[model samples]
Target: MENAERKELELFAAKMRRWIVEGVYCAKSGHPGGSLSCTDIICYLYNKEMKVDPQNPKDPDRDRFVLSKGHCAPALYSALGLKGFFDINEMKNLRKIDSFLQGHPCIEHTPGIDMSTGSLGQGISAATGMALAAKLDGKDYRVFSVLGDGEMQEGQVWEALMSAAHNKLDNICAFVDHNGLQIDGNVDDVMSLGDIKAKVTAFGWNAVEIDGHDFDQIEGALKAFNENRGSGKPFFVIANTHKGRGVSFMTDNASWHGSAPKEEQYNIAVGELDAKIKELEG
Candidate 1:
């Protein structure tokens, strides 16, 4: 990617981080750590990778994205809003009784959401089914899904992976946000997802691991996936990221996983992201 393009993406991701903090703080209940960690990848996908149109959201041939780790709806919602799916200000109303932006994605209500996903491991299955349907219908759209590292413990994710490979869903690309910390604590302490890359490769998919926050790695991984198309297997990218990535106090902190920040913390997060945005913009 060009330097200018990379800077633009960095700025966009920083804005998304601010939106995540704003939404969660306003809701007083929602996940922010993982949401912030995965913002860059989602921003890159929506802004530069996916062939999605806010104007023609239901276009069948458009690429699909499912946030398997759905509590991170704040990130997804921010991306969708910035992509012109809805008024970006609606993000501040997150989780409100009258707001369309719920705690988790609601496909029926949200314009950009391809699937309603909140259950830990179910979104990947839905993404796999979408890819299979595309193949069956001789369509060219690709399906993408993002999963939390902690979510790796769910057996259903493995089942979905098995099905994706067995069905030869090469059009599907899945990302495991290996951010180490979950709501409880370290993922290893909770349940070890030993050798995630090896496990995915053994499941008969192409696997690559990268630094989740690095735009170059993120872009390279996607390009590599495109280069490897027609290989008759699904693709998986294990992205090593820090929980609560952009905020100083929240980084790698398990307690921030599902908690709303207090006023002081929220201000600090916004301040940090603002400075980062300015740095990138310069």
Candidate 2:
């Protein structure tokens, strides 16, 4: 990507981070760490990669995306808002009883959500199914999903992988946000996803590992996915990322996994993101 294009995506990702923090802090409850870690990828997809429209959200031929690690709805919500799916200020009411922007994505209510995904390991299945349906319908759309590294512990994720491969769902791609930490602690200490790329490749899908925060790697990975359209196999991307990325104090901190930042911490995090956004704008 050119320097200007890369800077634009980076600036949007930073703004998404700011919203994630602000929304979570406003809710006084929500996941921020995983959300921040994956915001760059999410924003990139919505802003550049996916074939989505804010005006025609129900277009059947549009690309589909599912957040398999759905607790990170803050990131997804921010991306959707910035992409013009809804009023961005609605994010402040995140997780509220009456808010359409709930703690997790609700397809029944949200304009841009392709599927309702909160239970771990399930969203991938939905994405895979969408891909199969597209094929069956003789359509040419693609499906994408993002999963948490910790979510790989769920047996269903493997089942979904197996099913996708068995069906030769080449139109579908999935990502594992390989941030080391989860709500409990390190993913290795909780449950190791040993050689995630190898394991995914063993499941008969093409797998590539990249730094999730790097726009170049993200762009390259998506390009590969596009190139694999008729290869009769699914694609998997393992994105190494730091938990609570872009927030200095929260970076790599598991304590911030599902917890909202305190007022002071929120201010600091917002300040940092605001500074970065200002710099990028310049």
Candidate 3:
């Protein structure tokens, strides 16, 4: 990415962080840590990477995105709102009665959601099916899915991985948010995911590791995936990220995994995000 484009992405990330924080704070019931941790990846994909149109969301040839880690819907919703898929004001209605934005992604309720997912290991399978359908139809579009490190523990994830590799679904790219923290506690304590890169590679997929928060590295990895498409293998990106990135009190804290910020803390987080946004905009 060029210097100007890089700056634009940074600004987007800053605004997304603010949106995630504010949206969760307003709802007073949602996942904030994982949402914030995954903001950069979501922003990069929605703003720069994914070939999507908010106006014509159902365009046949548009790129597809599946949020395998559906609990982090706040991040995705915030990105979609900023991308004009929905009004930014609707963010306040998150998790409320009759709100389209639920705690988990629901395609029937939300626009631009390729798959409705909350069950841990199902979204990837749906994405795999989409990729296979595209291949059968000889479509040029690509499919992207984001999975959480904890969610990888599910058996269905490996099943989907095996199927994708066996089918040579090179048009698919899956991103693992290896933040090392789950809702319970440290992932190692709950369940050790030893050598994620090697594990995916062993499944016959091309795996690359990158700092999830670094826009340049993320962009480069994505470019490599696109260039290497049709190499007879799927692409997997292990994004090493902090659980609660960009927040002083939230970073590396598992308690914040599902906890909403209190009124005072919310003000502080909003202030920090606002300052960063202003700096990036300048």
Candidate 4:
């Protein structure tokens, strides 16, 4: 990516982090650590890569994305809101009573959501089905999905990967947010996902590893996926990321995995993110 473009993405990601923290802090009941961790990848996909139109979100020919790790709906909703899918003010009402933006994504409520997701492993299955549908219908649209590192432990995720590869679903490109922390604690302490890339490659996927926070690497991996299509293999990206990426106290802290920041902490996080955004934008 060019310097200017990289800066723009960085700014967008910063704003996403700000919004993620703000929404979770207001709700006092949603996951912020993983949401903040995956904000960059989501921002890049919506802002630069995916051929989606907020004007016509249901456009069949447009690319599809699934937040398989759906607890991170704050990030996805923030991305969608910034992309013009809905009013950005909706973010403040996250997890509120009868709000469209719930704790998890609901396709019926959200304009840009391709599938309702929150069941950990089910979203990947839905994404695989969408990819297979595109192939069966001979459509050119691609499907993308992001999974939490902790979510990789679900047996259904591997089943979906196996089906994607066996069906030769090259239209599917998946990412694993390898932040290494889950709700209870460290993913290794919970259940070690030994050699994720090797396991996926053995299942017949073409895998690429990259730093999830780096715009250059994120853009490069996405471009490489597009350039290397038609190889008859599903693509997997292992994005190594920090659990709480932008804010100081949250970074790699398991306690922040699903806890909302208190008033003082929220101020600090927003202040940090605003400064970063200003620096990047300037």
Question: Which portions of model 3 show Cα errors greater than 4 Å?
Answer: none
lDDT of 3 by residue, 98-185 (tens): 9999899998988898899889999999999999999999999999999999999999999999999999999999999989999899
Looking at model 1, which ten-residue stretch has the lowest summed lDDT? 273-282
* Clashing residue pairs in candidate 2 (N, C-alpha, C atoms within 3 angstroms): none
Give the distance in Å from residue 189's predicted Cα in candidate 2 to where it truly belongs. Answer: 0.7
Query: What TM-score would every model get versus the actual structure?
Result: 0.99, 0.99, 0.98, 0.98
Q: Residue-wise lDDT of candidate 2 within 18-56, one digit each (tens)?
A: 999989999999999999999988988998989999999
Query: Each model's C-alpha lDDT?
Result: 0.93, 0.93, 0.92, 0.93
For all predictions, the C-alpha RMSD in Å is 0.8, 0.6, 0.9, 0.9
TM-score, predicted candidate 4 vs. hidden true structure: 0.98
Residue 127 displacement (Å), model 3 = 0.7
Q: Write the per-residue lDDT of candidate 1 for residues 1-282, one digit (tens) a residue.
A: 898989899899998999999999999999999999999899999988999999999999999999999999999999999889999999899999979999999999989999999999999999999999999999999999999998989999999999999999999999999999887999999899998888999999999999999999999999988987899999999999999999999998999989999999989999998999888877
Please give the TM-score that candidate 2 achieves against the real structure.
0.99
Model 3: pairs clashing at backbone N, Cα or C within 3 Å: none
- 1-282 per-residue lDDT for model 4 (tens digits): 688888888888888888899899889889999998999999999988999999999999999999999999999999999889999889999999999999999999889999999999999999999999999999999999999999999999999999999999988999999999999998999999999889999999999999999988988899888876898899999999998999999999999988899999999999999999888877
Residue 205 lDDT in candidate 3: 97
